[model samples]
Target chain A: MHPEPSRSLPEKAAPSLTGWGGSPAGPTTLLRPEKMRDFKPGESPQIARGMGRGYGDAAICGEGHTVLTERLDRMLSFDDETGVLRAEAGVSLADILTTFVPRGWFLPVTPGTKFCSLGGCLAADVHGKNHHVDGAFSQHVTSARIIPADGAERIISPDKNSDLFWATAGGMGLTGFITEVSLKLKKIETSWMAVKHTPTKDLDQTLDFLAIDDAENPYSVAWIDCLATGEKLGRSVVMNGRHAAIGEIPLRENNKLDGSFSKQKPMPFYLPSFVLNKFTVKAFNSLFNLRQGSRGEFVTKFDPYFYPLDGIKNWGRMYGKKGFVQHQCVLPHESARDGLRAILELVTESGRASFLAVLKKFGPEGRGMLSFPTGGYTLALDFANKPGLDEFHDRLDGIVLNAGGRVYLVKDSRMKADSLPYMYPRLDEFRKVLRQYDPSGKFASDLSRRLNIAGD
Target chain B: MPGIEGTALVLGATSPMARWTAYALARQGWDISLAGRDVQELRRIAADLILRTGATVSVREFQAEDLESHEGFWEDCVDQMEDLRCVVCAFGFMGSQDAQNEAPALAQQVMTINYTAAGTILMHAAKHFEEQKTGWIVGISSVAGERGRASNYVYGSAKAGFTQLLSGLRARLSKSGVSVLTVKPGFVDTAMTFGKDGVFLVADPKDVGGQIVEAMTKRKDVVYIPGFWRLIMFIIRSVPEKVFKKMKF
Candidate 1:
């Protein structure tokens, strides 16, 4: 037989990397494997990174190997009859949408940014606007091929290796390097979304609007005015959407099935840190409320409805070089109102002026042990990195803890290690699975280390 | 506009550049035969291309270093696509210069895969295209072949020989209605240069692939990816050999 092609070691480079937040940057050895055959567990304490879209350090393995899966992206097979797709973990949701949307297929659940990798979605168990109706991303994942520290590849699914599968669903890549994933795709009639915008005068009305069970609309999200206090506390414009039927789209428009959207010019450079102060943020928030709230009801392309921020490339750079931290937490239905009010009041009193504030209603708890979603209301806020921000976060965390809520590890850059157990009652079970699969703790990240999810 | 109705055979189909090129061709409504050593990998690529573009795709086994098997490989490709109109050669070995310096076999293998075997396959394609009197042959040579640098002279010399081969074939087939386009890509962001140091102005394989298809449609004889590389290579070629030998790049 012809000699097997030499297994040339995958390329390696030492580069200073950061998550999308741009803070907590560290030097690491990055191994980029281009083909599936080339993907191997090369170093201890390694993690897989795709697009580095995670807000914090979930994808970073500081001073260790960070296997970049971007180049390994390739859609292996697609069954049009069943709408099932088998793709490499590095494939971006944007790529999948570009390929399948015209074919009348869409992702069952997609986060705000389509730039995220499938593996990252699984690791974070990312939830979408439809979480209240559907669930987290892992719920649709049929199976995945992962290579742990031992370099032995295993196929884990709900029916087989069920514990490992559950642990890996939202295990944050601490379990292994996810190489490939197979997921079910949602079918759509058109590329447009029939959306309705309802303006709420206060937090109570906003929560009420979000809690409404509009059978037709499968997706809903709210853009909150974090700066508004007192009477207008938590003023928001809730946007509800569902895939538009072909009959709903205008006949005059050409290419009804075309899902492509215009991309905005990238942010040229990092704005000065002072550019996002309280006054500017308040003005922007007010303008946004006016513009979006007035839209009322309209049919728009799926891109703007699902991934509005993705229109501007590298939009995170708008937060400036020091970067910003996004604090996203979910409070159960019983405590959501009080918890969100306390959190918003804290922000307004501090005059921090969060640039973006969002809230979404989640349904039943997910099968993933560490998944962020549950029967709750999740609120996310972004605060610029400035002096005393950590202290501010600490206070916010305390409020969440007192309300019996837990921070989203994917969005979190700073959360006390001690509070993790209380936040996630199943942390011990997740650790037990990690110990069984990677007993030596071969996988680690800054977030995991900071939270001590995997013991030292 | 739809591409001319025919199939394009892409050798070394598993390489990042070749895969991108195949995608560009498939997007233009061209049927494709993706030939490579890894049939399993090629099948995956074939399925992907079909899923994305809905183009008819077939995979064939092609070992670049198997000199004796190339003629039969071309025959099989022709059998699969009776209306084959184009062939793209996009495979090469870029062993590290330090390793090539220490190992004679490695250097020999690099030269053989990049030049000798490549030339043999192209010769078979040239004969078939010359008889058909209407076809395109695109070879991915390198800008390093323009002026050999001490850092990669071994790889550069093989590409230089391949470039010369394409030049001769172009001249010979000029009256036979066959066109040959030589591509001189600078640093491409593929697996070959994923983490290599000092690689600048790297062109994306997708853009390069698109430009190659554009060049084929326009029937251009030679083109540099990104176009700016033409000037870069010109300046390097203008340098005197006496000074170049001592100057390290």
Candidate 2:
């Protein structure tokens, strides 16, 4: 066994990282063993972490040592024609996009953001706007190089270690730290998008439209007005799109110049804590809605339409000192409308305003045990961190639970520990697999503690 | 009579920080009013509080920019609240600094929104809280205000003004039972930070919200969310403007 970083023996630990949700409390020492040979059997750091992007505290190492695999980022191989990419767990989606998108390829599934590591994608079993057709990110994943607590780095897939494989999917990085991942990438003609925007009256219409037309589009999402009430509640504009064909491209210097889009600027500083009130948001939304509806049909560049939120530099500073919270939940198909309505109604009643409220339909269940998607409808609402926001979210959690839905663990901040099982039916199986790999009870996070997922 | 006995008003209550601060306070059993421009949305927020915390909470249509509506709204809020404990300002804007530099009008809009309107409302809130004497006023400030950088100077300048304003207000209010807490948060992960890359030590609104409540309950003077922001801003501010401007922050 290799010498421990600080302590000789493992301890009950929680792993913390700057994940998409929040930073969680984990163990103090984060050990990094360079190669698989360097890892000795039965000498684990208690827990392992990948590129920390499981939103909440799912990947945090609670009260024990953690093994960071960021240095393990490396490309193993690639299948040119099939666009099959096999890379180490540390490989970031951003890295993949920068390298592949320009080569006429894209991720089969991606979250709203693209900063996640491959291991994190598997841990959270992430999904994307195209989930209506392509399903979760795990659907594209063929296999992984997982290093279990026992210090064995082996390639795992559905065919081999299928139980452990599914467990790791949505497993929140519990089964092991994925060292490598092989995934299938979708081929595209060019870095252009053929998008069609449709403005809907409210949530009902938005849902109806999505149900009717979601099948036709590869990427679809609706931006809802969570603050709208009465007749206008859930008013939103849906943008649906597919990759543009090579022959359809119009010649433009900027578009054709480098065959890639320009990098977006970052918001640099915090604004004074008074500008983003209801008046401003309403006005902005009004203008935005008007623009969307007025534009009619136009084939614009892919970057702006698909990632408008990405254009702004350091936009978070706009929320001022306190920051904001995103309450995202996915309800099964049967309960989607009611779940959406209830959540929206709660937000409306609370008078909390959201600048961007996104709604999407997931295509299928991923192989990961704790993965987020399960053929359902997902909605994410962004709220500024005013006082009493937690109470508001807790009430939201109740509404989510009452509707037989659950908050996405990746995006949750206020969910009750007991409520997790209600959302994921296969919790017991996930726990069992986690324990099998980590019998020492290492590998924990504040989310796991808050939701009682692990560290019992 | 206008102020509730144990209630606090949250300006821009829907902002992530404001919401979190309010949540932090509510945990201590303090009644809260999640005030914002949308009356309908405020009421919903109030209902949500009632359901979650079982707190006697309510909401009102509060527009800081609409000076004319202030008196009546304050009066209405006072009538509903039992023990007006505090007023928290968690409002701000970060319009593109480049856009502001290009369009002088946009710069004015940024300053007016952050300094003029928000400051005026805070002054109004201070008067109420000061008169009550047994109240708290927590204003969410930012480290950017430490020293304006060209990257987002318009926004930074406005925040600087507000930060100074809060500091002065705190100095005056210290003697009174009314406590003023200034909160400076660094990077935060929200819709606003949707596309940001390589951001360091960013915080979540819920965490900040929890911290805000903790500060309020503890009655601290000034607190920094994610703590490291304090050190970060100190170092940033310490750098000479000549050197600071030369280096990309």
Best by lDDT: 1
Q: In candidate 1, what are the lDDT values of residues A404-447, reduced to their tens digit?
A: 99999988888999999999999999999988889888899988
Clashing pairs in 1: none
Where model 2 places Cα greater than 4 Å from the true spot, the runs are A1-18, A21-52, A213-215, A253-261, B1-249
Worst 10 residues of 2 chain A by lDDT: A1-10
Give TM per candidate: 0.98, 0.60
lDDT of 2: 0.71
- Stretch of 10 with least lDDT, candidate 2 chain B: B189-198
Instruction: State the lDDT of candidate 2 residue by residue for A1-456, as single tens digits.
Output: 111112122222223334443323444444554333332333433445666545455655545455655544545566877788887676677667766776667778777656567877887787878887877887788887787776677778889888888987877766766767899998876777777778899888998877765555688888786767888888888878777776666876545312344487876877665777777877888888878856655566656756576577545567775666678887888888887888888887777777778888777776677877777778888777788887898888887788777678777767777788888888988888878877875555556666777536
Query: Which candidate number has the best DockQ?
Result: 1
* CAPRI-style quality class for the chain A–B interface of candidate 1: medium
